[model samples]
Target chain A: MNSSSVAARGTVRVGPSGRYAWIALTAPLAIVLLLFLVVPILSLLRASFFEGDRSFNASGVSLEHYLRFLTDSYYLNVMLDTLGYGLATALLCLVLGFPTGYALARAKPHWRRWGLIIIILPLTLSLVIVVFGWLVVLGRQGLVNQVLVFTGLIDKPIRLLFNSPAVIIVLAQQFLPFMVLSVMSVVGHIDPTLEQASANLRANRWTTFRKVIVPLSLPGILSGLTLVFVLSVSAFITPRLIGGHRVQMLGSLIYEQIIVLLNWPFGAAMSAVLFTVTLTITLIVNKWLKSHPG
Target chain B: MQTRRTFLVSTVAAGAVLAAPAIVRAKPFDNVTLTLNGFGGDFDRIMKETVADPLKAETGLDVTYAPGGSSAAVAKTIATPDNPPFDIVLCDSPSVPELIKADMIDPVTPDKVPNVANLLPGLPEFGQHGVPFMISSSVITYNTEETQTPIASYADLARPDLEGRVALFNLENTGGVLYLLAMAEANGGGIDNIDPAFAALERIKPNIVTLTSSTVSLIQLFEQREATAGALWNGRVFAMQNAGQPMAMVAPSEGIYSLMSYYNPIKGTKHPEAVATYLNKALSDEAIGAIANFFRYGPTTTVDLPKAVADTIITFGPEGRAKIKTLDWTKIAEKRSGWIERFNRTMA
Candidate 1:
């Protein structure tokens, strides 16, 4: 082949050889995913349809577990509450993360590195430890109460932990870095001259940010929201520790079924439902994002 | 060039030298290792220092420890029955029935472990599939500095003054199950009729701040003064008190709910001989005494303890043991899931 053709071949394109190369490159990953992910999921789905305990299937296949979960008002409420918490956490993270991510993207190289390190520091610690740290800070005689009482805001310490707000706040804090990192990656690639050009066209700071910056950063915002929401809904330890008995999430319920109660079939059914719901939401979001490309 | 006699003599001498070490080092069950699922943290340390190391010296067999809760152990066994993770499991009373029902454990008889004979009377009646090693009771534990009034009975938890201060155990924990049973019996109901338990829970619902299955989180709650009083295992209470925390435990007027922890040999263990030997060692006076001294749990074997220590352990003597209210574990295991769901609903 000529030099141009060789160069063209080196650069990936949609041809028979390129397609084969792509297949070869992804073959290992495809095998790994099939073995670890798809196989286990299929097994879980099968277990969900089993009539009796995982060890015994003599009773035949049925959807009794699913019916029970769907029909029960208590389980339905838990599912709704979990989704609500996920949405609230995603919104909270977006509100807090957008500015931080923007600042980091526009910062000097050294400052940006330090900012990234600070954002990622909590992720390095164990989730259990972080939850415990939150307990100490939000307890009745904790820092917030102490500060409030000292300032004469209240005469006595109020209950700060073991409630819905605490669970959402702690979850948002736990997953904030994911949102920030997602936004930062995409925002960093956006041309700053566009914002300057918008300013030159007599647009105010807020207007420029709203019309130009936000629209440009749509991909990052969508990804961050999806990531945070999915993670928040499936989180068990944080809600269990912080929300206590008053707040019951679907994740903790599923955990109780599988680990504590040892009801594998019921747990599998709940898991299948959660997976389906999450996957469906993700697919719809992706489709919407594709249709409304920035 | 060498004579036959000289060659034979030299060969025999070499053989004797090589065989002498083997003869001297020969031990029953040598090179055999068994894994035991034990309670982690200080319990594992005490067991290692008391039972595991001594058993290793007594027999050439080695005993490795894997630390986790009894439920986790049972679940692992059920998941992999043929090739179980641990050869032997240490489980509580609630788990014993489940294990028996599943036929996951082998019957540990007097022929295998001679020390099984020394176990407290009536323990053998509980089950022969495993050897009982330690005894603990569920009692009311409170932070003395934080609690204003003395807690005497389980019903006192419903007092208006202690509202929103109590930290309770969720139904998943064995202690939690015992608490519910104790509440039921204290009221007009028993294990068969648990409606009274739910009613009592409703009465005390205003006082409940948190319900959890974690011992560590419970202790943290006490340390942080988030919980003033709640039901907890006596051993953990004693540990916290010994650590200089202002914690005290009371055997309520209702009666102490006793629990027996057992060492069960898996049914299909490759090292049955080693497991039996290890159990015997674990049930010996020295091992049981060490565990009692460290954890303040009543010893299943007839090992003598100091009067002060014995007095502290509610299940130590006949009188203390008499105060223990035993329930039908089979019924508890059968109704546990439903009870847990109801408890969650009631508390929620």
Candidate 2:
């Protein structure tokens, strides 16, 4: 009885000591985070309020840079465009990825592993290469046009090369895995019997999916949606390359400000805005996930 | 149990994802333990053989070199105003403003490097601030097989016949945009008046087969017979023509964007004198030839090129130089966002 009590005590998570050990274990990471992640972010925040030839210490802080982003319709349009793309990507990922996840989940063990790898093939290739490949296929002299012309599919090649839709499709393709992985992981945890039980109780397969599996996957779906949305919002390469400078995302804008224009403060402000907007959406989604029963 | 493992894995994965940009530093300076801070590619090698090895031979300074992806790499080094990380740096034209903004380039007075006189008069934008090392400019190019007429004008780039066969430069680089603006200027279109030309550009938009971000690939397209007509630098065109590609260069009826390459003495560098010696050598006739050979760009020296080569370059003649409109970088820098927005809206 005494030994059992001792073992129970051992199993208990220690409070501060556990945290201390965790901190110790992650100390290298913590130090790296402090110097790299934390410092740069803080520097970015500090930079937002100041422009060129301006000091950040005590005398130079201003609201002009933030105001500049807010007032500029070009930037505002881009922000809206990015948000639109993100939402579209999230929706498409859910629609396509759900079935793909279902296929993977229902597959035999060996096939499931292979299925998982095949799903991750896009992720394996470099983003630049993917964008370049897409460009070659989509451009004027690209293969699609040649093939289409040979087949007489249309009189002339449709402008698939550069547009917002191109960004949406590319982004959906890039981020589909995030949604699949999230929902698949959760679906794997679910007992198969619950689904069967619902179907066995005179419920159709669609009804079983609608009621049992879907409700259970709702939280995972929400999480995936939020993640994919945020990622799509900030994705620079796809929009920049595939969209042909038309699908301007907030990420590309930040890159321009930081790298091209050398407007660190403006870039930082833009980043802060991005971070806040993304975080707000994420929190709202998280709250929705919590309040609504899955 | 699997879910628990998955959660832990995801948490760690998220942490790493958050930490990625903070950790990897693009290998900082490549390969060698000690690094030389200059433009990468053959320039790095030339400096290694000529300057870096001898320095290491004398002082045991370990050195390698990194290529500038964009001007930002050089900008960050200038911002801190600390022990400047690069031993020496070969920067492009755009980086000049950044260093100027930071006041990081140690003002090399005439007292330091006497060979400063060799720089063409009123040439170095940053006064006594950097050693003027190399210079090159984009000359209009045409495919010999495709076009029968001489490609002499910026207006020629907008020909209806070349429609759908045109090539676009990478918008990401300063060079392409600058080239476009120079074309605009030649066509009696300043930034304010660029709309009609941009509208015309929209007509030619469908012909843009490849949008190359790489200058090498831009030149290579000429060699490969992939693109018919595009604005290419003289050096690249010459290199291609020499390599047996039937490419021709045009002295622009208007102008070209000249890339003036130079070595700026980063403030607080340990070896300013060494930097000066290297800069002096770089401007010298022999070193300029080496750079010219390496990059295929024209020399900064007043010495005349061979007649055959001079005939090929747009900036070769006094008349050509007079016609070229110099970009006021300050004005361009200030209203750049507006230009980009108009460009973005019209370009596609």
Candidate 3:
């Protein structure tokens, strides 16, 4: 290469001038995040520390709202229920998605395209539309009930919705694509020759999967778990629609506090608690993933 | 016999003299636009046709409608007191005290809105800070097809026959709170002593199919034959009956709680005069009558309606109005948060 080309390449790399160029390119995005995301979060945290009434007027800095939430068995149960739903949804997605993802990774290119499209089609639909669609399938006098009734399975329509299980099921369906995609990317990158070599050595398919494939795909599994769990815990609509008043999550509680009750300080405290719980779980998972590198 | 220049000058002087009074007599709020939050769907259409459109045509004052629920409007106003999104807020009875306590809405006086004089007696007692525009009540609503037994009173809801068929509004809804109060009153307790209400709710728990804040969900539940009966607004029941939904409503034997909506002018509104004018237009006999006829809601003002329309509205006229058991909304407002927490715990 010419000296001029070499000098240009050097400048384009991570040199002092290149670092400045990187900062210049990313500065607008950084400022936008600071204003929109970080500032709002900080304000939410501040709001949580104050004691307030029905109106938005803050009395003063106090941990009374947090104390109210923490001390109350109802609120604590709601928090635990939210985390439970998250875990259930993640596990359900993993159980269903892992197999589908492996098949997608192993399938022919054309078939894989169609499978991926099928997996992503639900994502394109509106959340409301999807929830309503589930309602149609799970509601009393719904299609499932009709089929069951026609086949003499039951004399009447059974209640299939308005419960935590329904919420987790709907949540898993809603976030399954993320799990599948995560698994597919990692498993697809894994060498097929490893599986062939294992078979040639007389190791069975299950043995190869359990020992070789799963350990190597640990990164994807952890990522999928984190994504699905966070999304499920933060979900308000599915729980509201499917679980009805029987199930109360922190997300819906915060919505009720702020929108229905018009109590911002209490709502903000609930939000902070939710955020802290989610962050702690994510950090722990990420740390474990780092320590047990795939 | 006059010169041309002299004739032209005299004509100009006469024209100026005639036009002076017209310019001085121009409406102060004419051509001014005000934004107000309102219930969307049919309510918005009827409101525009009866109130906004007529006002715009008459006075050149335009009203832009931002559709949302009453609580949402209150929440938005509370978020930004200095710069409210709406100049006028169409809010429920519970929101009035909240708005007044926060000083988020301007207080109405007879001087500000002349039509305040025409309002029904005792209607303004509940909402002194705003104009009480319309009235609905939490009535016993049941599906005629699905409900095997007729529901005549609130007590009927707790019957064993109605098990797994009732759809109720959550505590977040104004109708829900009204129902809770009605239950408390009927069962030997009231707002001050609300223990009986929870005890009553426990009995009715087996009957409740779902608790929701959505009117749409209630309608859907009724349509799907999942829910047979529950407490719902008279206006919604009327609409559903009109739409041939096999739904029927009755003023409960143990009296019904009034669901009143108000026109609250935001405190920091730029055009108070315009807001007053809009309220005046909305409260006019024509507008009130139109709203009553269409929505089957009782009007706040003393506007005569057809016999059929008046009969459909349970809160209309003296006899119908007597059926309404007034609530202590101020007390309700004060104890609302505690009640909500208690309710959530009970329901949970």
Candidate 4:
């Protein structure tokens, strides 16, 4: 209660004051955000306001690039192509991935481990490497074609590398693990007794699966769908390498605008649109799942 | 409530970004950090020796070499921020537009690096904001051991004999399209004439063993003789030939499709002066010769070389590697999507 003790107590309340810790935390985080995300995004946004060469207008901003993208059939087609392809890839992943995930979740432990490993292998490899492997096999007059031709499958080798098929196939394969992993995480957590109990009620296996298993795994299914949808929508390498420039996906278009064309603002706009679209789809799907109570 | 998560994430992100400009976090002086970003592999060594060594010797700078490949990566870093990992960016021709659009790379006044005059003539058109460093081309290269007949033109490959025996870089860059355009013109169709070119390729559709984006793939395919002929950068051919791969680099009767490599100093680089200095050394006769020797491409320096060095350069000379092709990048850039679409639909 003495004045000296009161001052000592005040010092103890805010002991060891220093600026380094704040700087240490803020600095790295700031660097990551600015260097990786914000700067690119901001530059891209700023670039969109201006067009080709002339330093950004000091006077004001314009929507010239937006107008250009909107008005041009070419770019519109590109955007549509991206959405269509992305949706297709997502759907294909769901179809291919869900069964595999279900099987893995319900299978014997050793078989499940091997299945998970098989599914996860591509996830560990760089995207460029996997796509390159596909091209070597699926390309026109490639190994498969060579084998087929040698076996007299056809008179001519086929062109198979750059197309919608390759794009969808590669994307489904690329994002398959994401779908499987997500679905498996949910399905694995579900009570097997629910399905077995339904079976005990004399529900057929198919009936139990459709009524109990499918409904129960709905959350996981939604998560997997959202995951695959978002990834497929934003996939640049798949469309660029396998889709060719022919199949203009949103991810590649963003890349073309910002990285290739150096139109930062326009690319930013494109990215913003892409982000919104992805978010909206994910939200919608989640809402649908919740309403269904699955 | 639904948006709370996204809003929080974005808020934190924005705050961090706002705080970044002030986060200098100084290291030390004469620690003049020079990040030399360029091509990978042996090219990394040449950059280390030619540009990096001399700069470090004189300036006591901490020169770090980032072995990044492709224009997109360099451009991506430059576009990201005022403080990028790369200080000096060495990019090829196609990337100039990307850099200019982002304004990620500042234009260097020739006065900064007066040595740029020694660069090839047509460089200005290709690189407006950057300096031309070296020239690399997509030329027709073949394994001499594979074919008995002398391969001369792209049309030659269209023969049934070559069916399922050729390798090609995928239909992504202007290089492939340039060759296609040349074939189009030769087939009497012209630059926009993709149909004839497609028709030509269709003849030997089976011959195009694989479509690869990486130069390494094409080289591998050739080395294994999985494919007899390939369209590759002149450097790859020269390097492979020198490595005793039994390959012949042909300037092709249709002309070589090329990307005039340019050196770009990134914007927001505090070491702009140092970066410019390295670029100058890279374009220097000694440095260019060393790189040329290592890479198997011609030097950018307009210096007379020792006869030993003469064997390496792919000179455009009087006929100017006449038969080889230079791409109409503008046209190719415009119709790329359409061409790719049609190509995929028809070929796929």
DockQ ranking of the models: 1, 3, 2, 4
A1-294, model 1: which lDDT tens digit per residue? 676797687854467776678789999999999999999899878878888654432246899999989999999999999999999999999999999999999999999999999999999999989999999999887999999999999999988999999999999999999999989998999999999999999999999999999999998999999999999999999989999988899999988888777788898899899888989999988998898877
List candidate 2 segments past 4 Å from native.
Answer: A3-31, A51-59, A117-125, A140-159, B1-39, B42-62, B109-122, B142-151, B161-172, B180-229, B237-248, B284-286, B302-311, B316-338, B345-348
lDDT of 4 at A127: 88
Give per-residue CA lDDT, model 2, range A1-294, as digits (tens).
Answer: 576686687866567777678768998998999999999888788888775523322237788878887998877887888898899999999999988887777778999999899889999999978887776676556788778988999777655755788788888989999999888887887789998898789999889988898989888788889889999999987876676544678898787667666667778898999888998999898889779856
Clashing pairs in model 3?
none
Per-model B-chain TM-score: 0.94, 0.77, 0.91, 0.82
In terms of TM-score, the best-performing candidate is 1
Backbone clashes under 3 angstroms, per model: 0, 7, 0, 17
Task: Note the residue pairs that clash in candidate 2.
Answer: B34-B62, B34-B63, B34-B64, B35-B63, B35-B64, B36-B64, B164-B207
Task: Judging by TM-score, tell me the better candidate of 1 and 4.
Answer: 1
lDDT of 3 by residue, B243-327 (tens): 8899988888878688788999899788888898888888899888887898888888899998988888888889888888887
lDDT by residue (B325-348, candidate 1, tens digit) is 877887888889999999888888
Q: Model 1 residue A172 lDDT?
A: 96
Q: In model 4, where do residues sit more than 4 Å from their true spots?
A: A1-81, A103-121, A136-160, A245-248, A265-273, B1-30, B54-59, B77-85, B94-131, B142-151, B154-230, B242-247, B254-259, B265-268, B302-309, B316-348
TM-score, candidate 2, is 0.80
Ranking under lDDT, best-scoring first?
A: 1, 3, 4, 2
lDDT of 1: 0.87
Per-residue C-alpha lDDT of model 3 across residues A230-273, encoded as one tens digit per residue: 99999988888888889888888898888887788899999999
Superposed on all Cα atoms, the candidates' RMSDs to the truth, in angstroms, are 2.9, 12.9, 4.0, 14.1
i-RMSD of all predictions: 1.4, 4.4, 1.3, 6.1
For each candidate, give its TM-score against the true structure: 0.93, 0.80, 0.91, 0.71
